[model samples]
Target: MTGSSSADQTVSDAPTAPGGRGLSPSALATGGLVALVGYASSVAVVIQGLAAVGADTAQITSGLVAVGFSMGLSAIWLAWTQRKPISVAWTTPGMALLAATGPVAGGFPAAVGAFLTVGALIMVAGLWRPLGRWIAAIPKPLANGMLAGLLLKLCLAPFMAIGQAPGLGLLVLATWAIVGRFARLYAVPAAVAVALAAMAMNPPVSGALPADPWPTLSLVAPAFTWEALVGLALPLFVVTMASQNIPGLAVLATFGYTPRVPPAFLATGFASALTAPLGAPTVNLAAITAAMCAGPDADPRPERRWQAAVTGGVGYIVLTALAAVTATLVTRSPPILIEAVAGLALIGAFGGSLLAAVQAEEERIPALVTLLVTASGLSFFGVGSAFWGLLFGGAMHVLHRWRPAGA
Candidate 1:
């Protein structure tokens, strides 16, 4: 994990691939199972974000439906090309960020516009190979620092929620830690599954969920407003890029797999853009969650992870259809059950990312600056901490840059 460039590892270092064009049944099954657990944990974050942004119950449902469908399609298409299990979802941080900026934008439609702007810019970033290369070339610590800084809030959220329901949150947290000991596959599923079972068994928790899960497609007419374009949409785009995609690629490299980053970013950005009006903000690659899907032990055939992603995408579409066509069906879930589990599930992933970010010797200060500013929650002049963390960290690195003539 140290000293070696995980990205530049030669083919000889990689495990030998199975002699096959696609994944075996076992790999596919493992992939699908992991994908489902990961996606389920994050889905409620989307719903909560929409609600926070002042989306009515109906508009919130519509946004989720759109996002689900877009994610499903994007994953399927990208998996077909890459043969790796890549999944896309709402930026949990970005959503939390939006909850801060979204209300000032007047309505959900404006928030959607913000999401659209983020997609367009990110797609451009994908096309701009220089930018992609530069981002990839950045020292791992600075990137990790930025990630840690950005995710600091996420790590803290579960405990905040836990104050209300110790039983549920502790259950999920325990499951997250223990699952790895038995079978890594059991961790996320067991967390989510147990949460659901607890909610079902306990009437008070179960009552929060709809008696019958029914969600219908209700479209929110997008209101084109400049505030959303600047305040909401633009900021979200930056968040997704800095806070989500870059870290996601880092996770991929950490595991010693390299794929086309530009296309992957573009695909997720485009999907988020197309679905923004419905309420889903910038959708992008998942870092920690994707790691769960990509371990060496996940499948005998490494490539079959693509099938897991495809299965997840399909499942997302089904969820979307259900959410869109009927409002109550999926929405009638116990909020704390899923929410607490997601926060708990992400705890380890967040720690791993932060650790990587701060591990570098030369980049430590910059990474620290990035982490401090990001965790500070300082928003000034309409920009958020993600931008500030990068600005401060990158600026620090540049200020210390060495040159032959200057030195």
Candidate 2:
């Protein structure tokens, strides 16, 4: 938490071994698990979201590559530089928003422009102290509640998938439970492996993959318009900030690690801006998966845990080469099964967030309101519910604090 350059220097100087003299086997394993869970689980949503915005297959493939590279680079740089396990990820809520909004007035190009705007917003928030501080000032309970809300539906996907594919789904859940009892860190990754195996055995009915396994960048010229900007950009920015960045910081805080905030924001913002033309969405600090790398499981010494994030980044970069192929395979799999595996992976994180949300008695009402509003999926004037949840919860908190006792 203390902003001391000497402390960072000391950690960076610490001995380690694996890939050179600064890597550990545990870190590498945790990193691989983080990358696997982050990408394999929700990549379908990204593909669908891009398609919903009228992006072609090539564009979708390119988006995946760009996003993978961006997050990988960001995670590597941030973790290594700060000497902290600061994993980065694309905003899931932003993808969901894009998927739900469908094509804007100007279509995919407009969505690209909107993404650029969101990137600029993130960069500005990083540069402008007030904005960053304002976002940071959001109450911890409310932030946790918003995250819990965002994760709740996805966390329940296992049961839903069991209804759709009972045998396989139950198998996946059973694997997760059994593995969790003995080796909690490896549980989700093992479940993901099982899910992938099931998908391989019962492959979906897609026609074929491209002969060229590589995904090429397809530049989409920006088409800015009020419709797209307001309808997409603003909401995207808010969700990325509140549901992703804020909660991400909270996740780090929970582990007693606080890297420099603006640098993290700026790195993702720059990455977003650079990749927007390739139809990539915004990359930000990871909220859910951060716990995996930051916790004691990654490394007994918290100071050395950053190696895990760097390893995850390396994993992302390696996976980027298979972006097109992976996207094709994932899209072909049964959507419910992928979601179920994702839900199983996130159950721990969801529970942690929910517990944090209601820890304090006085904060319970506001926290619950935030969770309900965010999960309600309410949108007004094109603003997503994450923003509204924070606004309403903040207002409620203010009133409660200002009111007389017992009133």
Candidate 3:
């Protein structure tokens, strides 16, 4: 009976090991720091996207609440269950896409419906083998190129921000450079801390901050239309998949943790679906921040690194309570400061994607084409640049493959 009991204990403990042991100080610090950096870098873009879609203050607050809860909860669950450093995030490119797309014909309600559709599509992409295979089958270079193109504009923001707010921007850059010299992982978050301090030192005069930072939940009933389906939903679905989810998976793979794609897709999709009426856009696998949690800095043991992600998840949940405060502070601050921080945060990702896009000789031309089209921000007949970039690049690749050698 003692042996049997021992055997049962071993079986139960085996799975939880992936989530790691001790929840060490290093893991906790890494997780919380990465979470802080992730939120500080991209929350501004999300606010802008929601505002562009006509969300009021209360609605935006609700959106933040929903997004925070979804990402936090999902990341916790995925990391704990799989014992892998799987971090989930709102699609930054998808937010950019929405901001650029502006208002839909049917307004914010229509946009909410489109958000629901995107969630449904993401769920299908996860659950449907054919769709998952199709996504996986996409050429790596083209995917990288599309990501590069999509990010080019935002990545350029630091320079522009410098032009707009020279002192603050320069200080932010200088801090990032200095901190990165010793502790590369903490560099951006440190820069973010400095930038916030600088903002406080020189507060903006607009001073429209709310008295209370507690966010109120607001529901916007979804109204789906054919135009929204074609214009917003389809394009959002495409970019979120091509630029966010696929590359996110690739990032994890590089760290030797290849999670099953469908579960992630389903988790994020359901989260997005449930939060749509509250004004949240789609949530997907995190690309840049995942690298932070999955890297060696998070843990010496690859197996134990899941603790970092779980910690990051816990940090995110703690941050949800501060959403209203963050939103208020960010909205009232000078826009250039936020832009500079975001651009700086994404510089590494942009460089990595660009390298991936051009690494192969055969894929060079197609990848270049994809990057150019995506950066150009060209749209046609309601489709966004990312979809067009992939479409054109894929065609170019196929044509190149068909051509005879020495032709």
Candidate 4:
């Protein structure tokens, strides 16, 4: 409902192609674009998120490959079977949550366990309709507030990088700004290219590539802990559900495609579970990229748009080969500089979330409280600020709405 209106109008205005339903050139091109834009825009954030949860270079590479393959395969299966443009992606917002909630008590292994927990929860939510509804029922303002708070520090990295290393920071920032003016979709990717080029030219001492640059899956023994479940898993599940899955479905619906909900959730949830031991976080339906695959730009016929998602899935599978190189580049860059690119990538999301957080006058106070508490990084009894922020915000919201009996 929130992000669907304008796009619905755009699709409605597009001319319909008069031909049999089959894969078209436009679908292929748009599908490839979807894969590129989706991957390049957020890969830095994904790397940082894994590292934040204590993943080593090898583990990071594994995580990248796992998530890439999981999303690719799931997207392919869902689109092929459902005949709908049901694109799947790694949860960018959930990755942001991981980055915000750095280093759980049991470290990477525990993080793996947390990922498993989220997968199970997603699967359960798919099987139990009420659970999914409960997640969707969370107030938009509070959800956006929590997301904005999670993004606050990372979003500041660009300016902070400018202060610390103006040359590198300005190079990336300027490229993003200049490119964004012309092609907003490619802005982050362009900035990433510049930052990687700069880093390659002068690698930092601490930022060294791994001896084996080829991608390899490393199995991590999962370790469960109360802190990880309470701090990492719960918030992760909530964010993925609220920010990714719900909006993603809404996008597809806006395009007049009603793919079976349970199957999509089960597929992504199963994929997430299967890849968790390899260090991936979570995979869910993609909101932004879904628009690309499902829109008339991909194919005039709605029935044939699924081919775009299929092609996009194939593109993602091909990109899995770049995991090693991408991980190496991320590792070799100055951390702050890489974070600057990540921050640039997230600037739009931050702005949108910030606007959504305070858009409703009635919920403004509770939403602001959520944002501030989350940004404050308040942790208690091993739980991170995100959970506490939602808790406090939810409490305030309830108090605000409560009234005397028969008032």
Candidate 5:
């Protein structure tokens, strides 16, 4: 009877280990810091994008607040279930492309429309299991190449900023890399330390800040247009699924685990669909950022990486509470500081994605085309570079497929 009882226990459940003692709290802290900086950098960029497109500050912030709230909540949920480190970040490339086309295109209504369309499509992706698999079927080389090209512009900001602000930027970059490499636990502290130190030491510290340090949430309305769907929604959806969502799954696979992709995709898709009415962009899997929270450095056991992500979600909540604080603090920081920190944080991730993008035996040319077109920062037919990259790359692949071996 004792032996039979022991057998049932083993079959029903794997032995549970200590839950809280494993991860480097500091690494989680650093990742949260990275998310904070990355979020700030993207916020400044979004403000610029919205302005270029003729959006009022209030409208832009409302839209942004919508996005902010959804992202924070989604990250928390993902962290909870996966019990693996996971986080959701705003679309840097998506916003950049929007900024580029915003002024000349259909305008803010169009942008909101695009966001909604993308959200709906993502919902479709969730229900259509085969479609998700098809997206997964994209050759890794093509995907990785697309990623590198997509990220090319964003990644360069940090080093360029470092060159401009030698005293502060350099210190932050140096400290992040050194501590991130060695102690690991001190990585985030190093970045925060440098940022605080710079703020204290820099002479031009007289920037006036907003009165409210906490955001007051108000309901926002949505206006949709067909043009926006073609221009923003379709392109954003393609990139989110291909570059972000695809690589996100790869991160889990790299760690020798497989998740129920359909549910994950469906849940985020539903999340996006719901939030779109509120003016936030589509929600999808996080690639590079998720990796930071999930990888070996996050937890020695690897199995316990989820704790780091949960920590991040909690931190995100705190930050969200003081979003009014977010705007002020983010505004006070120099653009270069934001850029440099983002660049350094993404170094490892970008490298990995680039490698995965070009490893195919037959599709090298198409892969290169994808990289070049994406890196060129070109948008066409209301579509962003990721779409163009895939279009051109896919065409090239098809063309190559039809070509005779010796013709």
Candidate 6:
């Protein structure tokens, strides 16, 4: 996803005709690839995240289907209407937060309430510039610190898997490492493929698959709780905005596409809210997949790259059918094995976040506090460590800057 200034200049100088450019085979193929890669790379993490927060198999299936539909439809709408290579995706980092946070005070229903709260917050941020600005103002180091801490446990799963089941874990890790050497983008998917094959060869004790392999929308009645709001909703919103939406817009800009931010946020926020009852979490602009669709690989002509997004959207809709199968497999497998795959998928993100967390000398101490507290899994009064980490780090940051009078 790296885009240099020279590449930006190249894309910017390409052409005009935002509305009239017709679809080409290259755009179609790139779009399809984007969808396949995006889904395969992280769907395991999504399933693991849902299950962590007390979702039963049915709820997880519904979440997968709802998330797929929401991201797919919203992406198509944005790309078609805006005529830009705008992409939508479920917040991967936020899902990691869920996996790390584990179950809340009131279980899955409470988590659903937290999800709804996040959707509302996103919409409000879109409608009110100050709120969005406020979120943006959260110190990058602390934000990355929290993310790094949240990801630490899951990132260790591969090696831990090796301890738990050496043969299976090594097989998966070897596949990921070997494929990553040649093709980094496909490494996780390759590992996932190996894991799935292994699972297929030796089915879990929980034998039967769902009676119907097709995913259906299952409504979850949300129950808001103080712990859910403070612990889950707020952190999820911050992670989604900080990690996903903002970076997604930046990716588009790097590729020389400046979409209207408010509308993009509004659309995704609305989609998240509408689908929350159906068990989906927040849907927002994509960062990595946005690059895949916006770059020259998708289409040499910037004006026509929107077609890639449209096709990618269609591809997500098509892949919704696999949600039930995916959820079933995850449910039946040993949780640690599935966690190992999820961990492998997140190693890149973990490294990036950890670096970002401690990169600035001025923010290093505060950020380190945040990272340690979060990684420690400290909790109090029913609230999770994520909120505590942010709070403690933010306190340290403010204190660090609070010199008496003028130094």
Instruction: Give the 10-residue window scoring lowest on summed lDDT in candidate 2.
Output: 1-10
Best first by TM-score, ranked = 2, 3, 5, 1, 6, 4
1-407, model 6: which lDDT tens digit per residue? 22221243323322347543766777787687667657755777787788899988788778888889999999999888887889999988788889999999999999999988898888887877664454446676776677667668877888998998899999999998899889765676677778778766765455223547776778999999999999999888888876678656645664567676777888899889888888898898886677667766566667888898999999998888977675555555566676676666556555655676677799999999988888887865434566677789999999998999877
Candidate 2 all-Cα RMSD: 5.2
lDDT against true structure, model 3? 0.75
lDDT by residue for model 1 (1-407), tens: 01222222322222234543654554455455544555555556666677766777667766766777877788778766776667665687787776565475557766666667788888888887776576567666666676566556656755755676777777777887788678664566577677667655653322112333465556656676887777776667767776677767755554445557788878987887777766666778876556544434344344554566666677677666555322332234445455565555455445665666666677778878977987797766445565677778888888767567856
Tens-digit lDDT track of model 4 for 1-407 = 01322233222222233442555776776677667657755787798899999999889888888898999999999988777788999988788888888999999999999999999999887887764455455676876777667668778988999998899999999998999899765676688778868867875444322556578888999999999999999988888876678767655654566567788899999999999999987999986677667766566566677788988899888887877665555555566887777667556556656776788899999999988998887865435566677789989999999999999
TM-score of every prediction relative to native: 0.73, 0.82, 0.77, 0.65, 0.74, 0.65
Worst lDDT run of 10 residues, candidate 1, spans 1-10
CA lDDT of every candidate: 0.63, 0.78, 0.75, 0.77, 0.61, 0.76
Model 2's alpha-carbon lDDT is 0.78
Residue 268 of model 4, lDDT score: 94
Question: Candidate 3's residue-wise lDDT over 182-207, tens digit each?
Answer: 87766667878887787667654442
- Highest TM-score scorer: 2
The superposed Cα distance between candidate 2 and the true structure at residue 6, in angstroms, equals: 26
- Steric clash pairs (candidate 3): none
* Candidate 2 segments whose C-alpha is farther than 4 A from its true place: 1-24, 104-107, 207-211, 223-231, 381-385, 405-407
Top candidate (lDDT): 2
lDDT per residue, candidate 2, 175-294, as tens digits? Answer: 988998998767777888898787777655652235378778888998999999988999889889877787687566655565677888899999998899998998998976786777
Regions of candidate 4 where Cα sits further than 4 Å from its true position? 1-20, 130-211, 328-407
- lDDT of model 3 at residue 17? 57
Q: Check candidate 5 and list the clashing pairs.
A: 83-306, 141-357, 144-357, 145-357, 158-340
| Candidate 5 lDDT tens digits, 1-407 | 00110011111112223653455664566457645764666676666665665566556555566666667677777666655556676666566666676653566666666676777776677677675565556655666666667656657866776678777777887788788788756665577667766754544433222346544443444566666666667767766775566656644443433455666666677666676555455656665566566555555555566666666656655666655456556666677786666566556556665665566568788888987897887755444566577778878888888968688
**C-alpha root-mean-square deviation, each candidate:** 5.1, 5.2, 7.7, 6.5, 7.6, 6.6
Name the lDDT of candidate 5: 0.61
